[model samples]
Target: MDEIITRLQRIENLLEHLQAERVSKEFYSIAEVAQMVGRSEYTVREWCRHERVRGQKSRVGCGGTTEWRISHAELLRIQNEGPLPIAKRFG
Candidate 1:
C-alpha cells in the first residue's frame, strides 16, 4: 500500500514537471521551435526559409543579422495540421 502511494506521488510530480514546460511566449526562435517539434535547428530554419511554417525574420541577432521566429499560434497549427502550403511567388 505504501509503495503504491509512493509511485502515484512520483507520477504526479512528473506530470507537473511536464506541464510546466508549456509555451508561454508569443514568438520563439528556431532553436526553441526545433526542440518543441523534435527536429533539428537546421530543419526548422529550412521550414522558415521555404515559407513552409509561417515564420518571420526578426532583427534579434548579434551583428545586426536577422533570425527566424515562429509564433505560438503557428506552432499549434503545425502540431495539429502539419506545415502550411508554399506561398505563391509574384515574380
Candidate 2:
C-alpha cells in the first residue's frame, strides 16, 4: 500500500538522519538513547513517560533513583512504529 511505503520511507529518513545508530545487545541509558535518536535527554525521558520507548526505572541502593535503562528492543520498536514526539530538535 502507498501508506505503508510512505511510512517506511519516513522511518528510513529518520534513521538516516539519526545516523542509523544501531543499538548494541545491551541496555542503554537516556543519554545513549538521545544520541541514537538525535534527540535530547529530556525528550528521551519524556518518551519513557509516554511509553514511546519502553524503559525501566529501578531504584538503586539506599533508595537512590537510578537512570532509566532502555533495551535494544525498544529502539527497534521505534524504528518500526516511528520516532518519539520531540518538542525541539538537537544536534
Candidate 3:
C-alpha cells in the first residue's frame, strides 16, 4: 500500500510538470488556437477581427497579408469564459 501511494504521488508530479510544459509558447497561431478550442480557423479569425477574443494582427506586406496571433493567457481566458464583452484587438 505504501509503495502504491508513492507511485501515485510520482505520477501526480509528472502530470503537473507535463501540464506546465504543454503551453510553452507565449502566443499561438489561429490554426493552433482553433485546434485547442476545437473551432474552425475562419471562426477563430473572426473572433480576432470581431474582438470576441483578444489577438495581435500582422499585416506587413504589399499583397495585403494578414495573420492573427493569440496569447496563451488570452486562450486561457477564452477557455474559462466564452468570447464576449468585445476586447480591442492589438498589434
Estimate every model's Cα lDDT from 0 to 1.
0.87, 0.78, 0.87
Q: Find the number of clashing residue pairs for candidate 3.
A: 0
Model 1 C-alpha lDDT per residue in residues 1-91, reported as the tens digit of each score:
9999999999999999988996389998999989988899998888788888899988875788899999999998877888766668611
Winner on TM-score between 1 and 2 is 1
Cα lDDT tens digits, model 3, 16-66, are: 999998766988899999998999999999888888889998775698887
TM-score of each: 0.66, 0.55, 0.64
Worst 10 residues of 2 by lDDT: 82-91
lDDT of 3 at 37: 92
Top-down TM-score ranking = 1, 3, 2
Query: What RMSD value applies to candidate 1?
Result: 3.6
lDDT of 1: 0.87
On the 0 to 100 scale, the lDDT of residue 57 in model 2 is 86
Q: Over the full model, what C-alpha lDDT does candidate 2 score relative to the true structure?
A: 0.78
Clashes of each: 0, 0, 0
- For model 2, the stretches where C-alpha displacement exceeds 4 angstroms are 1-23, 60-63, 83-91
